[model samples]
Structures are given as C-alpha cells and as structure tokens.
Target: MDSELAAASQWATESNAAVFIRLKTESGVVQAMDSEEGDEEENEEGEGADVIEFHPEFTYPIYGEHERIFGYKGLSINLNYAAGSLATYFNIKYTKRIEQMESTSTVALKADDIDTPMRQILADSVCATQSEFAQQVVHDTRVFRPSGRKVHEYAGRSSQTEQLRYEIYSSSFNDTESAKYHERMQAFVLFFIEGAQFIDTSDERWHVYTVFERLDMNGQTSYSLVGFSTVYNFYCWPDRKRARISQFLVLPPFQGQGHGSALYSYIHAMVLGNSDYADLSVEDPSEAFDDMRDRNDMRYLLKHNAFAHIKGARVEQSAISELQHTHKLSRRQMTRCIEMALLKMIKSVKSQEFGEFRLFVKRRIYAQNMDLLQALDPDERKHKVAESFASVVDGYRRVLSLL
Candidate 1:
C-alpha cells in the first residue's frame, strides 16, 4: 500500500495532475504532497494516519477529507490535482477519464453525438414518410407490383400516372452551388429526411429503412419506392419504462390507399402484443393529412380502432384552465402567464436545434391529443386541440431547462 501510494504520488508529480491515495486496510492511510515543494504534512501524528491537502488552485480549499467517495471500493482514494490553468487541466483530466470509461459503460450519447450512419438512415426515412410524392411512389409500387408485365407497356397505358410517379421519385438534381433552384429541391428533401427521425424507437437506438416495391399491370410492370422511418423513445427515463413512438411517416400517393392505415394498424398491433398499455398523440392533424378528405379518411380509420377521446371533441380555453387549476397552477392569470413563458422558451432556441426540441414538445402534445381522441366526442376534439397546443408550449419550456 505504501508503494502504491508512492507510485501515485510520483505519477501526480510528473504529470502535474491531482493524486488520491486510498488505503483499504485499517492501518492504511492517505496523504497529500505539494508538487511545488515535495513537502508532506502528517495528520494528527496518529498510527493509522491519513492526510490529504488540496493545492491552492483547486476549487475547494485544502482537500483534507471527504465524507464519502462515489463508486469506490474499500478505502477509496480520490485525487483531483493538476497543474496549469484550473479549467484546462480539469477538462483534460475529465476527458481522459471519460474516454477510458466510454467503451465499458452505457453512457448516454448527446443529441450532437448521434453519428453519421444513424443520421443518414433517419434522414432517408423522414423524407419517405413526409413527402407526398414519395408516399405516392411507395404506394404505387406496393399496389401495382403484383401483376408482372413490361415497364414500357404499363407506362404506355398510363403515361400520366407513370410520368407523375417518375417526376416525383426519379428526378435528380445537382448539389453543386451552380445547380438551379429546382435542383436544390433535392437538397431540401435530403435535409428534411435527414433531420427527421427514421427510427426513433428510443433516444438510445434509431432505425431507418428505404422501401421499394414493383407494381404489375396486366403484362407491364413499373417500380415504386418509398421510405419508412420511426423514432422511438424506448427506455428513455428508465429501462423498464415503456417506449413511445416519436415519429411515423408514409408518403403521399400511399395516403388514401390504406397504406398509412395499414402501417398504423400493424404498429398498434405490434405494440399491443408487447404490452397491455401503449399511447401516442397525434398533434398535427394538418401534417398528418394532405387535405380535409385525407383528414376525414384518417378520422374514419381512427374511429374503427378502439381508441377514444379523453375529454370530448372541442377543448376550450376554459377547459384548459380547469385542467391547469387541477394541477395546482390554480390561478387562471398565472396559468396564462406560464403558458406564454413556455412559448417564449421554445422560440428562443436556435433554429438548428428547434427540430430536436420540437420532438420533445410533440410527445406531450400527443398525450393530450390521445385524451381528446379517446373521448369520442366531437366537442372534445376541438377543445383538445387548444389544450394540446398549450401543453406543447408548456412542455417545450421544460425541455429548454434540460438543455
């Protein structure tokens, strides 16, 4: 133990970093030595003596003794001594520790730390899910693929359809600075796809996929393609916690042909199989549907499922106030003030970080939306929208503090 402490002291002296000496035995002891002057101070002149001192530059004055050391075995010794500017030295030492522990530990990766492979998959999936033209291509491919025929023959019969699909799915544009504005649209597509979550099954793991199908009409066949991406918040708070669906996308042409409904049904069933309880909120009815017709279609589909609205069709300001009061925010004026504050928090974030923050807010909105949806009352849905938006704003503020 004496040899080990001496070695640690030597390392501290040479590297100009802090050193801690831990003694596991009752006779074991800890001591601090000044790097500037190899001077040692004895602690109380006792038999099982342990001494520790902090350099002047360290935050805490005189690192003498600690009540407890975190994650240490036996008589753990912790030393955080370093030479040079305090911040820089501490940063370097902390970084070294982090790097050393990264491989063996299940550390959470920051939003910025998400890698390129995951990013690319997410982007592709988002584009396929959100774009109307992309959705159509996917739908066309799935619906048309069963009949085997020549591509040209099918195109000849349905030139308009084929051209529309081709224009939407096959067109390519240069990414160079000289590319035309229309050419730059491809980049926007790429950006949106990449920014969107392909597989947000959880904060820890994301999955993305590009889907393609061949359609056959009589003897002619054409190919259609689409992308599917999902972001799941699995085990976000804890490993045992249930997962939340962050994002789901299917392209435009696929909208009315039961593809979206089918996908949702499949997901719903899958989730139901795994757990007796699962929930998601649909906050953006506008984004969810291309038009009123599409929205109505979705309404019909949702109605078929056992899902019901929580309150009723329309959520009024009064209802929100009532809910707020129930939560103990009580004063109507105070709740309004709080709501405004939350909105400001969200709006204050940098544009690039907005999307990330938006995901966090959307989950809360969804939860509120589910309450309204489950109510199966028309008035409740309207009120739920207002309530849901308020909840989103409030949730955004809370997320800001986390950053």
Candidate 2:
C-alpha cells in the first residue's frame, strides 16, 4: 500500500515545461498535448495538480523593463470549465509575441477581446504543470470565534461608526485550528495582490489581528470576518518591542467605509498604546495603504492636540515629541505625520500658507539633495528643484484630498 501510494505521488509530482490542458465535453475529457513528454495515462490522473511547460529564459516587459521577477522557470494555466461550460480562463503568451498576436484578426485577439470559440474548445478542462517546489496562494482563512481582541461597543469613539465592530486576534503557534484558519484566510489576498506566500507560523513572533463586522439581527449577534493583519514582533535594544506590520488587508465589500481607518486606530490604541511597544512598522506598503496610513495617523495626532501646536510656524521638536510620546510612532512615521499635519494647515496652493508649506518641504528636500546641488549645473539645478518641489506638493495634495 505504501509503495503504491508513493508511486502515485511520484507520478503526480512530475514537472513539465509545457502547458497541459483538458477539455470537458459531453462525451468525455479530451487532453491537449503540446509537449513532447505529455502522456495520456499520466494526464488522465492528477486533475487537481498544476502542470505547464517553460521557455529556457523569458522576460515580462509588461511588469517592468526586462522583468525577470517570476524566475521564468515554467508557466501553469488552467482553463477551468464546469457544468459543461467555461467557468474560468487563463492566457499565457511571451511579451514579445503580444504585438504580433494582436495585429491579425483571424489568428489573434486583442488584449481585452474575448474569444468565444476558444472557450468552447477548453470548457470543463483541467491542466496541471508546476515545478518541484509547491506554491500555495492561500493556506487557511477560517477565523475561529472569541479568538482575539473583540470590540463590542458600537456608536463609540473606538470605531468610525457604531454600526461597525472589529476584533484583533493575538495568534501564536499553539492555536492549531485558529492558525489553520489564518493560513487559509491569507489566500484571500491573492484576489487583490499578485505575489502572496504563506508564512510559517511555528515561530512565535507573528501576531495576527483579524477584523470582522458584528451583525445583530433581533439581538442575535454573529461575526462575519472582513479583514486581517499580520504583524511580526521584533525585539529591539533595551528590551523594547518593535512591531512590523507584515500584511494588512480589508475585504473589498467593507472597504471605502472607514473600516480600514477604524482597524488601524484600534491597532494603535491596542498595541502602540502600551508602554512595551517602541514603534510600529509596515512591510512594503502599497500606495493605497500608505495614503490610509497617513490619513489615520494624522487624524489620531490631530485629535490629541499634538498637531495643533505645529501649525503656522510652530514646527518644533518639542511639538513633535508630544505626538511621538502619545502615539509611540517610529521616527519615520512621526516625520511623515508632521509633514501631513503641516500640509493640512494650508488653505490653498495659491496662498502664502501654501508657500510656507512648500518651503517647509523644499528645505528638507534641498538639505537631502546637497550632493545633487553640488553635481548639477545651475540651470539644471533649478529644474531639479522645481521637479522635487512639484513632486512633494503633489503628495501633499493627495493627503489633503484624502483628509
């Protein structure tokens, strides 16, 4: 029994460099053999596995110039079909081939153009092609109840609106079932992101906080998990703890309703509020998350009167300290919040207030670009300064717009 199982596993684990696809039809399954080594018997099995062929070396210019990000080892695609119809689609073509493919109407289709005939050919098909190393976009995402920090009170300051509620889970290695759910939940990030990998939770450093909406119908409250965040606690010097946010995701349905801001506020109040927390960090935040971070941090600082003293020529270290001491923000976060607060004080881009704000940003940029000042010619230097000024002002404009 063990030997048979091992043989089946070995056969299923075989890797190929060509695309494997099966077409589900009313008659039976039909396989497409594009590779030299593809087998009918081997293809008949392992329907759930991924298989594909590869080019020796490939580059994706769409991602960036000569983007070798995926390592270009192999490509796997499943033209999924169910109920005798095409349910999902996959397309893979070399970057250089796209220009040629789109030019012909008979043999090629535009990027957005859907081919109905192609769908019929591969409907209800399974294709498996993957390399030696396994890839899992998501692990487990089922979050168990009463697992972490639950904020029950609504219509209060802790949340943006009393109608919404969230819980912050403190996950570790010992919580077996909850941890699996967390792994599965991490898979959801692939819906919005391209590259997402599972984290080994055996290490004790990870702290997972999941947010959910508390639904109450006829006084029967149920929790629907909405979003989750994973933070790694790193021990700093002097025995202080630095928490770096690894992943922060708020589901699409709950987004744009201030739930993200509310969750952030709760994290700050729960983690950074404590004396043990030295600072907070994020891991390669997306542009949208950065905007949300700026807005929420500024809102928190503004509410605490820390930003009140930094307006109208009041940019002082002591004033910054007041915010730092209250929020326990890292040096980088504090500086960004200060800049955002300074920009918020401005009424218009045409006014003197804007000039002061511009000067404030430019002065820092100038000091940082001293080496540039020494390198560029005088005419080029002016253009560089204007470019930097515009870039900084554009960021301020975004912050202000979000506010």
Predicted structure with the largest lDDT when compared to the true one: 2
lDDT of 1 by residue, 79-157 (tens): 2111100000011111111112233234432111112322332223222211232233334333333111121111112
Give me the overall lDDT of model 2. 0.53
Q: Candidate 2 residues 203-240, lDDT tens each?
A: 88887877655533344343555577788888978877
Among the numbered candidates, top TM-score falls to 2
Query: In order, how many clashes per candidate?
Result: 55, 20
Cα-based TM-score, every candidate: 0.26, 0.58
Q: State the local distance difference test value for candidate 1.
A: 0.30
Off by over 4 Å in 1: 1-204, 209-213, 217-223, 236-243, 252-258, 281-286, 289-403
Model 1 scores a TM of: 0.26
- Residue 249, model 2: lDDT of 83
